[model samples]
Target chain A: MLLSIKNLHASINGKEILKGIDLEVNYGEVHAIMGPNGTGKSTLAAVIAGRDLFEVTEGEVKYKDKDLLKVPVEERAREGIFLGFQYPVEIPGVSITNFLRTALNELRKYRGLDPMSAVEFLKLMEEKKKLVEIQSNLTNRSVNEGFSGGEKKKNEIFQMAMLDPVLAILDETDSGLDIDALRIVAKGVNHLRRKDNAFLIITHYQRLLEYIIPDYVHVLFEGKIVKSGGKELAIELEEKGYDWLKNT
Target chain B: MKEIKTDTKEIISKERMIGLFEKNREGLFMTDSEFMSRIRKDAMERFRELGFPTTKLEEWKNTDLKASLEKGYGYYLHPVIDVDVQKVFHCNIPHLDTAIIAQLNGWYVSKDVPLMELGNGMILGSLAEAFKEYPRIIEKYYGKYADFTSSGLTALNTAFAQDGIFIYVPDNVSSQKTIQMVNVIHHPESIFLQSRNLIILGKNSRISLVHCDDSYNQQASFANIVTEVFIGENASLDHYKLQNMNNDSTLISSVYFNLEQAANLESHFISFNGGLLRNNTRILFNGKGGTANVRGLYLMDRKQHIDNHVFVDHANPECTSSELFKGILDENASGVFNGHVLVRRNAQKTNAYQGNKNILLTDTARVNSKPFLEIYADDVKCSHGSATGQLDSEAMFYLRQRGISEENARMLLMYAFANEVISKISIEPLRLRIEDMVKKRLRGELSVCEHCVLHCNTPERPLEFDIDVTKI
Candidate 1:
């Protein structure tokens, strides 16, 4: 198992968000959590990424059979847990290339490896830049400073391609992306997918599911996984809106 | 009515200054020119009337120099130190070739002659020597720009300062080598010194000047320095001021800039460390179509205090001025930025802008920033803004989530913040050196160097970082 969550309960400022959520994922699989607005899909990703804003009141999370809840945010990142932020922050003055190189070298150091040379780092950056079809000049600019909405999503995927996390949880990565950007992002994810890694993608609409097929789809509503099924279930839910699930 | 309490220290300091002038009138300040002597006397009268600035004044409200002034500081009226000039100051800037001039305490020190006449028709030497050699030029511009009547410190410096760096660039000549002036203070006890510099750029001339202030010891000291720069019509001047002092020192540096028609000026102030530093920078556009870009970056921590007061006078039409000053204050460090721009009634088509931004690391860290603009011309553009805040928390989380350590993440953010001003540096070598210094400062590793910054960082020991900052 890549990640295991047992009866997870979380809240923000004494307001419960993820109430009694249980989920499990294994390697070489893709799982999509489809939900309506205000559902707990993003909160689950935050808890897994070790964001401190959401307090975990009960239960536990296990990544690769280790107690992941005790790890720090950066430590979790080094342990191959990547969280694509819903709204990427604009860090002025920090070039995208610099940010990525620093992040990659840090992960290497955590694993008792030497830092990457400038030449090799540049080569790797060049190779990864093609995955998202980002222009070479875009990497020289500040990280998401003046990037369009589509560019931000592509940058996120570009980062994912560079880090190559064991388990990637994307929080609304397709939210603000246009159709072209959605296809590029999905293609980038598909290119990075391997037999050893898994993805837990959170989305509100089924429009993105057509590009990147998921093996399993979970219907999340009111802070709980109310229904879980195969890929066909996503099409069923998309046909009969989430309101049907609420009525049931 | 608000009652003003009399301060005994201010009175004593004022009286001490007056007594020093009376004692050194004939001996230390003996001048051959009667006009120079009269300028000194007039300055003394202004000092007696103005005295040292007090907190009661609006400009000095945020900065209190009473603590710095209370220290018993010894005054040196002459050149008392005789040390090896080359051994004392070593400028090791890689690939940066500059004409170096040194000053010990307040008097200019040189191993060669008192003045150097370059083949390019430029003169570099001591101000005292210039008073005798180029009396005509000195009499024309010596006291023309710096307004001693408004500032008591400037008045005191004008009366007491004996020897400082002086440069003269003649008409239509472009200086190939940058002129570097290094003012070093090395004393065992608390000391007080005054220094004055005068630079003249003739018509159609261009020159780059780098002025550095460094302290070799930790003893308490107070420095009152004044510099008058005159840029002739169609001339250009690129000026840099790098100040790095120990925490026990106090520096009050007032610089006056006079620009004629079509003259251009770019000035950068990179202050790394200081105890109590206040920079009084005033620029006057005396002719039409002049442009001035003044930028400053200061990084201070501990109990240090820094204040920057900039005044721009658009006296002629089609003049433009921009001021951008940024600082990062940590611990209990405090700062003040006062930018005042005045566009006269007839100064049409004038564009003036001023901005001050600060990031306070701790809640106790504070900054008082006031950007004011007074425009009398109806056909002018003027704007002013100031912002003070902490590092963005969202950006912090974003960087940390990418596997960067908390410490490196903070450094990256702060570097990005300080780089905005550092990027304005036109000199490549100086900009690179300042980038390294700023990085070391942000990491809390910048120690008081043995010499100035240009000589401090040798090529052998480059800064080590786990992450590559060169790309940033």
Candidate 2:
């Protein structure tokens, strides 16, 4: 397994957010986690990204046979784990180019390599920007400042393409995006998909799964996954609301 | 009588100033006309009555100068001359194009070459020379703008001030080059010095001045300086002040701006490093359709303390004034920002705004901000706001999620906060230089920045933030 979480438990502010979450993933696979609101879907991704907000009281997150919870947030990124934030922050004075360069250099430094040249970085940014079809010039602008909802989500996908993480967890990346933006984001993700990498897409509805084409889907309800199935389950859930699963 | 309070703590500087004045009475009054002497005498007597402000006063409530005043300083009757001025006080701003004037130990250092004489009757020289050559002009605008009765420091500076920078622009003339005043305090011991500057912009004239206060030595010293600027009808003045001094220094600077009809002024104060700095900025819109924008940014750490007190008086209709001040405090450092805007009864259609924002990096760091708007006119739009808080946690989390370390993320946010005011600088080169300086300050790189002309030290703790403010 490329990543594994066994009997995971996490809480914030004395309130348990995730309880007894068990999941496994391998390379060359796209796993979709579909859940209703307040089901701890975002919390799971945040914990995996090493956010200090939650305390993992009873859990073990194993990545590449190492204790992933012991690593810091930035180190997790260096170790090939990326979390696409649902709401990107607006940094007023930090340009997009500067933020990305600093992040990229730190990851390179962790891998014991020289920092990328400015030319290389800009070229890489341009290439990745093509995947998301971002028309406006974002390099000179402050990060996420005054960006439309669609543009912010697209920028996230663009960043994922640039970082090329082995295990990418995009937490609710499809929310607040229009149909065209949704297609553009999914296209960007599909372009970056490879046999050596994996993606965990967290979404609320089946609209995005049509484009991303997840091989497996899991239903997370009230901080626990109640059911697991293949792509056919999504269509069934689309027809029958989540209340139908409560009877079983 | 206002029942002035006098104690031993504040009387030391006053006594020293009066003693120095008595000793140098002849030399001080050497080139003075009767009107000038009478102005000086009135200021001297006012200083005797007003004395130094105490904590009881509303303006000095947050900042207490008891410790600074108790320090024993050697008073100076004259600035130490005979040293090589050019070699010691060389202008080091890289690629900055400006008309430079150097002041050594509170006295304007006369350049060997002739002073700048722009055609159209614009003259830039020493105030001492102006007293002899242009007495009528000096007597007209010298003490006209500065309020010496309320501030003892201003009164003291006016009384003992013998030589400083003198700038005059005739009507319908505009200076092509920005004038830079480099005031270098290079005394050997703990000395108390007072200096005054006079700047006059005639009708339809324009000029920009970059005034910098730099100290060359680490010895303890005190500086009480006053500057009066008069902007005639339809004139414009862009003033920039940069204060960089050692850890054991005290600087009290007061600037009075008098603007006439349709006059425009943009003033920026950037205090990068200092021990104890108090800036008293007063602006008066003397006529209609005038606009004044005053902005300040201070980056203080360790034991440094900076206070910015701004007062804008809209005495005429259709006048606009705004004040924006930002500060980043680390370690045990503290700062204060007090902005007051007053719109008189006849000053209808006045637009006034005042804001102060601060970021406290450490638990021990402190900041006090007060914004006040007093309007006697019902047809005016006046607003005031102040904010003091820790860094935004959501922003921090977002940055860290992208793999930026906790340290660098905080630095970026601080620079961003201060940049809001810095971005308003219209001059490109000055804006860039200030941007670089602000970055160096945020990174605590001033101690290690070899290319930086300003020299300073950094503490060991390096202003680390409490990054675990995640509420959820």
lDDT of 2 by residue, B316-381 (tens): 999999999999999999999999898999999999999999999899999989898889999988
Error of 2 at B464 (Å): 35
Residue pairs in steric clash, candidate 1? none
Q: Provide DockQ values for all models, in the order shown.
A: 0.83, 0.69
Candidate 2's displacement at residue B213, Å, is: 1.1
Q: What is the interface RMSD of candidate 2, in Å?
A: 1.3
Per-model interface RMSD values are: 0.6, 1.3
Deviation in Å, model 1, residue B344 alpha carbon: 1.3
* Top DockQ hit: 1
TM-score of each: 0.95, 0.93
Model 2 accuracy (lDDT, Cα): 0.82
Q: After superposition, how far is residue B432 of candidate 2 from its true place, in Å?
A: 2.5
User: Where is model 2 chain A poorest over a 10-residue stretch in terms of lDDT?
Assistant: A131-140
Q: What is the C-alpha lDDT profile of model 1 across B1-472, one tens digit per residue? A: 2221122223228888888788767666675479788999999999999999999988889889888888777776656444455655556787777888888777787666778899988999899999999999999999899999988889988887678989999999998777888987766566788999999999999998889897866877899999999999999999999998999989998999999999999999888999999999999999999999999999999999999999999999999999999999999999999999999999999999999999999999999999999989999989888999999888888888889988889999999999999888877887888898889889888766634456646632322222221111
Relative to the true structure, candidate 2 reaches a TM of 0.93
